[model samples]
Each structure stands twice: as structure tokens, then as C-alpha cells.
Target: MKQLIVIGAGQGGLSAAIYAKLKGWDVLVLEGREQSGGKAGGIVQGDYLLDPGPSIIILPRLYEAVFAAAGRKMSDYLVFDKLPTISRIYFEGSPPLDLPGTREECLRTLKEIAPQDYRGIQDLLRKLGSVAPLVDKTVFSRPYLTSKDMLDPGLLQFGLRFNPLRNYRQMVDRWVTSPLLRAFFYGFPSYGGQTWNSKAPGAFLIPYYMIEDGVYFPRGGVRAIPAAFEKLAKELGVEFRYNSKVNEVLGNESKATGVRLTTGEVISAHAVVSNADKLSLLTPRDGDPGWEPSFSYFTCHWGISKTIQGLDHHVLVIPKNFETGFEELYDKRTFPTNPIVYLNAVGALDPLAQPPGKTLLFSVVTAPAEVKGIHWEESKWNYVKSVKSELRSAGIEWCEDDEEFQRIQTPSTFAQRDGNYRGSLYGPDEPHRLMGLFPLGNRDAKWDNLTFCGGSVQPGAGLPMVTLSGKFAVDLLSTR
Candidate 1:
């Protein structure tokens, strides 16, 4: 049997291991941390479980495909409940908008919120639906390893549809006129660390997917998705090693033979798959231009003593002065004075995940990636205070008095924990993004036997994309 080694036990790594094992490879996964799931991992405070990263679940079929590949039912390992109201959008001084799962409900809600933009929203969805299949075929199915791959006629035509000349904000303005709708659409680019001025019209597909396919919450917590993958991978005969940090990828410039652990243990394999941050593992060639740091997140997980009423499973609070916040974050490269807040109250949906009469709230704000000027150690707590103030202003009366326990994660945390370049969750910044849609390729450019799979690779960030990235890496290896 062919010997395969996978570094990191993230969603991508676990998926890669499972696929490789089914292909009859003797697979071993080496994780730097003591457990699996990477950023999708959970934090436990007393009896409450808090998810520090990736709360929203979309495109669950990507996960289901993994189980189907193994001839096992996904439901047997993981249970997912589709959220009826995907998120409640709370705009300052305006009535809160409930974004429902199905198209009819969404349309109805839009009609109530912005009567004039209802038609615009419908047209936008139609346009997105038309291009959805092409996006899947061109972007998701493969990796762009060279200039030729990007210059394909089909891909070029796809790019032209979005009019790369205009930025995301311009594209959104053409689709809707209401501030509420604009607020809802404007932030999708930030999901991949792109800004409004970024030439990333492809970001519009995020809301398109949410409205079309529906958003889901896995039973137990967001961590349950990776837990499911880890369980299935183990059952399929893949092996795992925790706290096994890789020091180097050993081989020549053209190929990777295996990895050397930090303890100086040399483990040789026929092929090596890296699910760690590719930037951390690969050395940049001479004259290779450095990538700009992309946007990252500041997260606060709180286990509160009591639940806040009128809170949904997912809630988005858009400040009235959000444009200034965007300018501050993207152009000025500072923490926004009026940041948009995303609050995920898992207990609102899953009662079992929380202790009795307690709430599990995870709040996130988009922030600049770790840059030289801004020191998180000095400013993180101050930022947290501001975020709590914003939460209270939005009617969530969470205070230090009500807090049972709190856990905070900043870009610095991701930098240390995941070794992400400049602590960017979505790899390189927007201006330097690959074809304006992807991260790096799944196959390493210099090493034939080495591959990459994770947030920093093709198909891009978010749990669904990383899950697909694993399959893309395996497919590249199989083809070689």
C-alpha cells in the first residue's frame, strides 16, 4: 500500500486522510494541537461549550459528500438542523429583519423591510442563480496552478460577467438601493477578507447560497461538524498523532519525501499532504512578491447567566455609521470605531448545548490582520470593551455581572495557534487574491508529491470550502 502522511488534523486534514485511506493508502495525521478541528475546535467553560470560530454552517452537502464517499450515512454521525430564520439583521433605528431560509419567506421579509428593493433582490438572486453553476464548475472543481489555468476562455467569460473593473460595493449598488439591503449585502466580501472596494463580485454568491441552499446548525455545536469528520476518519482506519508538530518538509526542491517532526523524528512517506498554513511550511522563492495581510476576526465567547430575549440563532448588528467603519478597517487599517457585530447564540437553537437558564454567545467583528502598528496585546481588551458596549446598545444587556465565563480570540491568537501568515484567516489580502476568487493552489508549485488543503488554499475559506479543499488536494495527488 502507498504510505501517506497528513500534517494537521483540521477539517481539511481529516477529510484528506479519509479520502486517502479509502484509496488504500496507509494514512497518518500529525496534529500540532492535542485535538482535532483546528479553528473549528471548541472551548469548554464549566458545563457550557463555546465555538471560537466558524459558527455559521452553509453548504452542508460538501460535508455529506465525505460520508457518502465512505458508503456511510452522514446522519448516523452528525445531525444538522436547518435554521428557519438564518439570521436576524438588526440595523440601527430600523425594525429588525429576519432573513428566513426559503426563498418565499426571504422575499416576503424583504418586501416588508424595503418594498422598492424587493424586486431588486429578486433580480439579484436570479442573476446569481444563473452564474452559480458556472462558479461551481470553474472555481470550486479545480485549482489554478498557472497563468494558463486562469486564462481559460470559460473562466475569462465568468470573470467578465462580474465586470472586474467595478468593485464589490459598485456591484452591490447596482443590485439594491436600500441601506438595510446594502448593509446585508456589503459584508459578504469580508467573509473572505475582502473589502467593499475589492474586485470580488464573486462574494455576492455567499448570500445567494444562504438564501438558496439554506444555512444549517449542526447538533451539539459548530464543533460537531469536525468532530463528525474526525470520528468517520478514525472509523475508516486513518491514524492520528496529537502534539506532533512538524519542523520541516524533508526532500529536494522538486519533491517532498516526508516531514520531520519538531522532536527530530523523521517519518518517511510516499506522499505528504499539508493541512497546516501553506505559507508557514513553504519558503517563498527569491524575488517572489510578499502578500499583503488579509482581514481577520476578533471573537468573544461568553457563557452568560441568563438568556437575552429576541435573540436568534444567528444575529447581525449593522451600525448606522458602518461605511466609516469599513473605511477605517480597509483603507486606514485600524479597528473600526463602529464595527458590525455578528452574535451567535447557540443556545437559542440548541438548548442542550447550554446549561439551564444560561446563554452561549459568540460575538465576532471583522478587524485588520496583525500589522506592525497595531498591537493586539495592548488594544484587545479595550476593543472587547467597545464590542460589549455595542452589544448592549443593540439590546443585548450582557455585562460582567451576568457573565459566567468569557473567552476571547484575536488575530494574534490565530497567528500563534494556526501559524497563519500575518494571522489572516483567508490567506492573502484581496488585491493579491488568486483570480479574485481563490487562495493558493492545492498542489504545491515546487514540490510534486506535496499538496496543501485548508483555508489558505483553493476554493477559499469557511468550513465548506476547507472541506472541499481536502478532496481537491487528494484529487491532485491521485492525478499525479
Candidate 2:
């Protein structure tokens, strides 16, 4: 049996270990934090159960299939309740639109609120629904080997359906003239931390992932998924060590061998799959190094005293100024002037998140990649004030001026805790096999006797896809 070592026990890492164990490999997972799930983590504060990130997971169907592949069932280890409403969209001053789960319901809501924009919303959905299956087959399923591999007759036909060259922003401009509907569609680009203007219309699949897939909440929290993974891994003989932080990727002349931990332990292994941020692994040292890591993120997790009734289990609130909003996040080297707020109130379903008469709200906004520790004190206070002001400015109220159940985290803090490349909470970017983003047979890794999995590797970030990345890694390992 090939001994496999996985670094970083985040959801992706834990999932990879589970998949590898199912394949009968001797698997060991090394994690920096005491728990698994990395950025997709959970914390318990009094009656409040705070999901540090990944507030609620959308698409319930994917879970069962993945769990079964690892010799378990979703019902056996976890439980979740379906949500009645998905999100509430409020842009500018139009009447707030509450989006239901079904396609008919969403169309009806669009028609009821923005009658003029309804036809466009319908057309966009029609176009997307028409081509989404093709995208899953032609782009998402097939691993990319080269740009030359991108020449697909099906892709051309699908591209023509969605007006491919226009970009998602341009596509929205032509379809929904209302600021509310525009914000409704464009707000999804946040999933990949992409700017709406430059975001590829190819991402329209996100709506499908939302409306078609159906969002859900674990009985515990988002962290429950990874915890389930950890349990499954242990049952299959995978070893886990928490608080074991690794600082360097160890190798000789040609390729990576294992890792060097912060405690001065050089653990050797036949293969090393990193579940940590990809860019973090590339941190350059004073003496020398290889490739570097990429990007940064600032995430704030807070617990609230009251239930946020207006929002569904998963709500994405767009700022009044959508375009100007992204410009500040990407170019200004600061937090969004008017941040796009995303609220996930899973407490609606899993009432265990907070005390009675209290709610758990995960409200987050994008901050610039330029995070320095120097001015963070002022930045944190400013972020709190700005988020509160934006909500009140839009007539949404949940907290008093003096409510103090909040905590702010900057990218610099992420770097200090665990070496994240540019403080990227995820990795440099997600790997799409169909896009040829990750091409090594069996997930098909390119490096021999060595493969990369987790968020930064092929099949990319998110819970399900990362497991697929691990499955692919094991397939490659078998051939050797």
C-alpha cells in the first residue's frame, strides 16, 4: 500500500483523506488548527454556533453521492433540513424580492417586482438552463490538457446560446434594466472572488447551482460536513494530528517529497497533497524558493442577539452601488466603501445556532487584497461602522448602534496564523479539469510520484469537487 500524507485538514483536506482511505491507501492528515475544515470552520460561543466561513451549503444532492463513495451514507453521519426560502434581494429602492427555490417561483417573483425586467430574467434563465448541462459535460467533466483542447463544437454552440463574449456584466446589462434584478444576477460573482465586469458569463451555472440544486443547512453547522469527513476517514484508518502546522514543502532536485513543519520536524512521504491554500505553500523565504502563492481575503464572523427575519437561510444583499462597489475592493486597497453584504441565517432551520429569541447571522463583505497589520485597528472599526451604516441606509435593521457581538479578521492575521499566500483564505484559484486547469490522469496529476489535491489543485475548491480531486490523486497513485 502507498502511504499518503495530506497537509491541512480543511474540508478539502479531510475529504481528500476520506476518499484516499476508501481507495485502501494508508492515509495521514496533518492540520494546523485543532479541527478540520480550514476556512470552512465552526466555533461555539455560549449559545451561538458560528461558522467561521461557508455559512450554508447549497445543492443537497451532491452530498449523498460523495458520502456513499467513501463507504458511508449522509444520513448515517449527518442530518440537515431544507430551506423554504433561499434569498432576499434588495437593490437601490425597489420593493425587496424574496427568491423561492423553484424556477417558476423565481420567475414569478421577478415578474411581480420588476415587470419590465421579467422577460430578460426569463430569457437569461432559459439560456442558462439550455446550456448548463453542456457546460457540466464539456467544460466541468473533462480535464483540460491544453488550449488546443478547448476547441469543442459543443462549446461553440453553447456559447452562442448565452452571448458568450459579452461577459456576465454585459449580459446582465442587456437583460435586466432594473438595478434590483441586475444586482440579483451579478451578486453571484462573489463565489469565486471575481469582479462582475471581468467575470466570464460561463459562471451562469452558479444560478443553476443555486436554484436547481437547492440550498441546505446541516443540523449542526457548515462545519458538520468536514467533521463527518473526519469521522469517515478515521474509520478507514486515516491518522489526524491537529496543531501540527507545516511551514515548507520539502524536496530534492526534481520534485516534492514531503513537508517541513514549524516544530522543526521533516516528515517524509511518498506523496504530499496540500489542503491548505495553494498560494500559502509558495511563500518565498529570505534565502530562496520555487513558485509563490497568490491572493488574499478578510473574513469576519459575528454572533447576533436577534433573529434576522427578513433574510432566508441564505441571503446575499447587494450594495446600492454594485459597479463602484467592486472597483473599491479590487483597486482601492481598502474595504468596500459600500460593501455587498451576504447574510446566512442557518439558525432558521438549525435552531441550535443561537439561544432562544437569538439568531446567528454570518454577514460578510469583500476587502482588498492589500492587507497590512499596521492600520488594521482602524480598518476593523471602520468595517463594522460601514456594514451597519449600509444596512440602515437601505432600511434593513437587526442590531442596535451599540450591539457588540462582532469580530473582524484581516488577511494579515490569516498570514500570521497560517502562512497564506497573499493571505488568500482559499488558494490561488480553483482548478477545473474540463478547463484543463488540472490535468494528470486519475485527476491526472502532472508530477510523477507526487500529486497536488485540495483547494488549489485540480477540480478546485468547495467540498464535493475537492473530494473528486482526492479521488483523482489516488487513481494516479495506483498506476505508479
Which candidate leads the pack in lDDT? 1
Candidate models: Cα lDDT each: 0.84, 0.64
Deviation of model 2 at 366, angstroms: 2.3
Q: Model 1, range 1-480, lDDT digits (tens) per residue?
A: 889999999898998999889888899999999999999987667898777799889888889889999999999999888889879888888777789888788888889878988787888788788888887787777878777788876577677676767888988888788887887788888887778888886788889889988999988888888899999999989999999999778887677888899899999999999898787777433232467778899998888888777688899988888888878887898998878899988786666668988888889998988876889989988888878777777787756798888888899899899878788888877656565556777887677889999988888889988998898888889997
RMSD of each: 1.8, 3.8
lDDT of 1: 0.84
Q: For model 2, how does the per-residue alpha-carbon lDDT over 1-480 read when each residue is reduced to its tens digit?
A: 777788888766776687777777788888888887776677777667777766546655556666888657789988866655667766656556678866667667768877998787777777787887786566445434456756777766776675545666787789888777666666555454444654356656677666766666787777788787778888878999889988877766555677888899988887777766554554432232222222344555556666555666665667668777766654454567787777666766766777787766666665554344326555777777777676665575665642447666676666666555555543443232234223222231234655556555555445655665666565555656
- Give me the runs in candidate 1 sitting further than 4 Å from their true place: 283-290, 435-437
CA shift of 56, model 2, Å: 3.9
Among residues 3 or more apart in sequence or in different chains, the pairs in candidate 2 whose N, CA or C atoms overlap within 3 Å are 10-38, 11-37, 142-434, 143-433, 144-433, 144-436, 279-293, 440-444, 440-445, 441-444
TM-score of each: 0.96, 0.86
